[model samples]
Target: MAYYISSFISPFGMILINILDGGEEPALKLTTEVLTGHVAVYHGDQIWRVEANPDWSLGETAQALSDLAFEAEIPEELRTLGIAALQNCVSDLYRRQPFVTA
Candidate 1:
């Protein structure tokens, strides 16, 4: 599995992680939109559209993941792994971005 990580540090410090098992740039790019408050998930061999909450909080993100896991019957351990993957991706992205010191 490969992950593309990006971070936008304006208005709010936000991190975006695009997780893909196959070489699907489109899926990775689509995941970027999720940072702007959109939800795209794999469903039945196709990507499904999901409504994102206006408030972008860790809890909100976790809940979204939980919902997806429930719908897809993903194992709890896998769900935790997914969240950890995302968290690691985001943290690395944040670390890479230049820090502004004033």
Candidate 2:
């Protein structure tokens, strides 16, 4: 169970992605540019069978996780573990991209 988030930052904004490593689930993405942001969670392998536009908020990251829990009818504890795992992954990524101003 691993999480991967890669970011592409630009002068305008950034594109954040969440991709699975050892799973079959499609990746999740949050993109921003100027005044608008988009959140999408993909479903399916051969093709995208489902799509979602979760509320645009940083908290939506966790909210999306909870939503998945409900949708998949998984146990309460799995949501907790999943969110924690994602947080750790983000922290690791941030470490590699430490902030700097120019």
Candidate 3:
């Protein structure tokens, strides 16, 4: 089970945050779609587009999850669970991408 949090900085540098619960199949599906859309809008056809490795560290993932939890007004215990889930996902992703270090 995993969760994800995303923040997009606009062209003017304004930030919009979205928190996703990836544990559920439906949620995971939706998150992937949303993330894909985000990437397409933000990075597609841009000279700045760069395929950087996703190497989010545990601390960074935890912090992102915490912020998401707070924003979503989820219970503290559930938020902790979400953080753990995100950490596990990040670890797995890191392993899959051998070059990425977390």
Report the Cα RMSD per candidate.
6.3, 7.4, 11.7
Least well predicted 10-residue stretch by lDDT in candidate 1: 6-15
Each candidate structure's TM-score, on Cα atoms with residue i matched to residue i, is 0.42, 0.34, 0.37
Residue pairs in candidate 2 whose N, alpha carbon or C atoms collide under 3 angstroms = none
CA shift of 68, model 2, Å? 6.0
Those runs of model 2 whose alpha carbons end farther than 4 Å from true positions after fitting are 1-73, 100-102
Cα lDDT tens digits for candidate 3, 1-102: 344655433221122333455533222110111232221111112211122123544334334434444455344544455445545555555576666443
lDDT of 2 by residue, 9-100 (tens): 33222333444445555344333322433323333332111233333333344345335434543334443444455455445545665562
Better of 1 and 3 by lDDT: 1
**Global Cα lDDT for candidate 3:** 0.36
**Number of backbone collisions per candidate, in order?**
0, 0, 0
- What C-alpha lDDT values do all the predictions have? 0.44, 0.40, 0.36
| Candidate 1: stretches off by over 4 Å | 1-15, 20-37, 43-45, 73-81, 90-102
Error of 3 at 93 (Å): 1.2
Candidate 3, after superposition: displacement of residue 100 in Å?
A: 3.4
lDDT of 3 at 14: 22
* Model 3 ranges with Cα > 4 A deviation: 1-66
lDDT of 1 by residue, 1-102 (tens): 444433232223233434444554423322324445655444235554456766665434544644554465444443455556555644554466545221
Name the TM-score of candidate 3. 0.37
Give me the overall lDDT of model 1.
Answer: 0.44
